[model samples]
Target: MKIAQICPRYFPDIGGVETHVKEISERLVKAGHDVEVITTDPTGKLNRRETINGVKVIRFRSFAPGNAYYFAPQIYFYLKMHSFDVIHAHSYHALPALFAALGKSERRLVFTPHYHRSGHTAFRNLLHKPYRLFGKVIFSRADSVICVSEYEKRLVEADFRVAGKTVKIPNGINLAEFKHLRALQKDEGIEGKTGKEKTLLYVGRLEEYKGVQYIIQSMPELQEFRLKVVGKGPYEAELRSMAKSLGVEGRVEWLKDLSRRELLKCYAGADIFLMLSSHEAYGITVAEALAAGTPCVVAKGSALEEFVDGTRCLGVDEPIKKEEIIKLINKLKDMKQNSRFTTESLTIFDWDYITEEIENIYNN
Candidate 1:
């Protein structure tokens, strides 16, 4: 089967959606299917073609930050000239999904709108009415719509009124690298420390909506623990200030643009993973943390909660309380006395199973 994945962004520019597309595309290719990705250029070149991880990747021009809003017309143009067994259009920005639907290609159309949009984005909010209209058109045109979580499926069903056709396919993780990465990094003593400390890890964009500030607020209350924040975004300075104001500035570590190996170490070495995102279509970091045998605190009512049960994840209903965080730290410190942290096999959500579900979708 030939699959053409249309996404607004791809790696070297990282995010949950990019990671999902990359993982699924690679797994499909490994399964003897052809996969091609259409995405926006990260180099700002807007060039048309390249290959990454054995998949053909095509990039076109886009306006940074807001360019994701206009990917539909570009995808429509690209699809007119090429062909695939399925065109999987991703994102909830309305543009790409609209074009993929409007293009009306003979092949199957599957829309996986990762739906990570906040109720912000002035243009998107202002044009909500027309956005709904366009969304209905695109959604109705698709053979099936895929959601990464039941939360997302419900949102799509509620908003788009496409309840019957939507399906859930949870995102998967690659655990091999994460398992070995900490030992490698510890040997090298990266982050200016020898081995894993009592650490709290945060990975993903440093954006306001991600609610990273909640973790920052919890830091002053956590005296012995170090907070390691990974990924790049616009909210760095504000977060730094919040850390300083809370008097935990010295313990806060800012890591930016880590390679895949380094990323695995950050995940593996951490005593706990934290994501305070108020709104998440799906949180892959929670899965990665689980795969690494690092327990996590995923906030309640978000999609991340679905991937995590109480045994491996602590679900907080609001910005994590200082007392709660400190208590968790103490619990982890106590658990460290044992050789292992927490044991719950997450092999079920591994890429192998996830790809099988996706293959089933394609076959159906």
Candidate 2:
């Protein structure tokens, strides 16, 4: 089968959606399917065409401001010209999906919105109201509307009225890679720190809606624990200044450009992981933390809450109360001491299984 995996960005630009597209595309290729990723490159520096791990990747120049809208009209022209058995559009937040849908090809159309329901900032959120008019095209044209979480599925159904076409195929992870990478970084002396008791981990883009500030504010009382933030975004400077003003600068470690092995080492070395994003279609990092046998505390109301079963992970409501969050963090710490972390129930997220499910959709 020849398939087109279309999205706003791809590998080298890390995020939940980027990772999802790359994982499924590569797996599809290994299954003897011919896969190509069509995406935008706002900076215009990346190659217009390239191949990574047997999957063809074609990038087009885009007009991206605050790196948000990703206005790339050439995408429509590209899609209209290409031929594929299926064209899978991704990320409702950007315009690439809209262009893909507008192409209105004869092949099957599949859409994975990875919808956040709204935007991360006031301006972006406001734009969503108008964007909804265009959003309908992506959903209405697709043969299948794939959602990564029930949280996302509910919103898609309620807003788009595509309940009949919508399907849930939650994001998947490499269950073994998390465990295998646990010992790689430290053994090679790439990251020299040890004795990480009471360490806290936060991994994702440092966006305002991510609720990372809430964690930074709690640092004074969480004096015993040091935070290791692992990702980059527009909010880094602001977060750093806040840390400095709060006198928690010494306790916060900002890291990015890390290899997969080093990142898993951070996950395995920490006592607890935190993903406080206001909205997420799904939380892949939280899944990775659990896969590494690390306890996690995630924000409620997103798909993240689905991972909280009161043992390996917990959920904290927004308005992120210091006492409430701290108590839960301590609770997870105690659970770790009691040997409560387990992966027996996490096989459902295995990438192999996830690829099978998606392949079923493409074939049908």
Candidate 3:
């Protein structure tokens, strides 16, 4: 079967949706299905056509103001001309999926809405009131609507009143990539912290909604731990200033351009993982931290609250005080030290299983 994965962006861009489509598309290719990714390039710097790991990728030039909305009308024309057995569109936040839904092609339109409900910013949030009308086309036309988390499913159901088929399929993590890091196997418990400083990690886009700023606000009190931030975005400057104003600049390491191996190591080595974002359809980084047996402190109102099972994870609300975060960090350290951690439970989300489930969906 020939499958088309439509998304906002693809490989080298490095975000949740980008990585999701890449993982599934490549695996579908390896499974002997011809898979192609139709995405947009706002900067017009990437190639228009290329093949990575046997999965074909076609990028169209788009107009993305403030790196939001990713308007690409060319995608509609392309899908209207071409045909595929299955056309899976992703990211409800971007416009390409809706464009794919609007195509006249009779292909099975499968949509994976990594939906965060509202927009990422104040301006974008205001646009959502009108955008909700356009979103109806994608939800109503889809043969099957796939949501990445229960939180997303609720939002999609409530806002769109979708009458068609819907299913919850969470994002998967590559546990094998973290196997050698020994985040689970190592016996280095409380003893490991005896002579060294704990590394607090924040690995995602530097957005204000991501709550990285809140972490910076609390940095002045977390003197025994240094921060390693592993992504770049518009909010980096603000976070840097916050760190400097609080005199924690030297302790906060801003990291970007890390290879997959380096990132896995960071997940495995960190004492605690922080993702205090205001919203998340599914926390892929939180899952990765869990796969690495790292303790996580995520925000409560979003899908991330699902990770808090009183084991290796904890939750806190927004508008938290610096003292609260410091307390949470100390609690997570003790929680991890007292319990036995393992990656065995992470097997349910293996890419092979998830790809097979999607294959079954297409086959049916």
Candidate 4:
């Protein structure tokens, strides 16, 4: 099968969608399908084409307020020329999906919204009207809507009113890469903490909606652990100030964008993974960390709960408090030595199995 994936962002600009595109495309290529990705030029310089990890990638110029949502004519023009059995558009904000439908491509169109609106504050919630209007246009034209989680499936039905076929396929990870990371693991034990201190890791954009502040607030009480915050975003300065004001600056370690190799090291070195997002259509990082044999604690009432069961991870309430965060961290710290349970639970999300499931979807 020939597949064409359209997304607004790609590699060198790491995020949930970018990682999703890379993981899916790499698996598709490995499964004997020809996969091509079309994304925006984050550098603002137009490049005709490039390839990464056996997948062909094409970039076009686009301008927008955020790095992920871009306004450009090139995307529409590019779709008119390419032909494939499957044209999968990721994210609901980008206009390219609607343009591709306007082109009237005979190929099956699959739209995965990666819907995560709940995390936003009241100010951003007002934009839902436009988002709903956009959804009505594109989802109505789609052959199917591929939702990444059960929560996301409900969001599509309730919010978008998508009449087309809907399927729930959870986000996946490359388990072998994580296994390789385990082989090169390094210890990062802090001096003041005991040998039993667990390293808590948070890897993703440090945006306000991500609930990084809640984790920072937990640090004073979770004195037996160290927190490692990875990735960069516009709210870095404010988050840093919050940590200082909370008097937990010494307990937190901030890291910008990390290479894939460096990321796996963080995963392997850590005892537990923490993702305290206020909203998540699907938290792929939680799945990845679990696959790496690290226990995860994510927020409840969101898509992340669909990926991690109680055996591998714990789900805390949204608007999480410092006491709740500390309690959960202590629970995970106690189970860190349960190697058999962690390894067995995460094996289900290996890339090879995930790729096979997608292959079956395409074949159908």
The lDDT values for all models are 0.76, 0.87, 0.84, 0.75
The TM-score leader among the candidates is 2
Against the hidden reference, what TM-scores do the models get? 0.88, 0.95, 0.94, 0.88
Residue runs of model 3 more than 4 Å from their true location after superposition: 183-195, 337-348
User: Which model is ahead, 1 or 2, in terms of lDDT?
Assistant: 2
Candidate 4 residues lying further than 4 Å off, grouped into runs, are 45-48, 117-121, 180-182, 186-197, 335-343
- lDDT winner among the candidates? 2
Residue-level lDDT of model 2, residues 1-364, one tens digit each, is 9999989999889999999999999999999999999999999888899999999999988898998889989888987887888999999999999999998578899999999788988999989999999998888899999999999999999999999999999999887786666466446643312454368889999898887888898888887798999999999999999999999999999999999867878887777789888889999999888887777898898888888888878999876777788888878767656776564666347888998999999988
RMSD of 4: 3.1
Residue lDDT tens for model 4, 1-364: 8888888878877887788778888988987889998877756665558888899988877775644356666777777787789888888866656665555467777778887654265545676666667667778778878787889888878876674578877777776786666356534432222255567889999787788888887877877778899989887899889889988888789987677777877777777788888778888788778777778888887887765576678888866887887887777666654433455745346656766776666667
Tens digits of lDDT, candidate 1, 194-214:
244578899988877677888
**Pairing residues by index, what is the TM-score of model 2?**
0.95
Alpha-carbon runs more than 4 Å astray in model 1: 64-72, 116-130, 178-197, 319-324, 331-341
Residue-level lDDT of model 3, residues 1-364, one tens digit each, is 9888999989989888988898898899989999999999998899999999999999999888887888999999998888788889998888998899998367898989888888899999999889988888898888888888788888888888873577888888876776666644354332223338888999999888899988888888887898989999999998999899889999999999899877876787788899999879988999998877788888899899888876578788767666778888988777656765433465228777788888888887
Clashes per candidate, residues 3 or more apart or on different chains: 0, 0, 0, 0
- Residue 195's lDDT within candidate 2 is 58
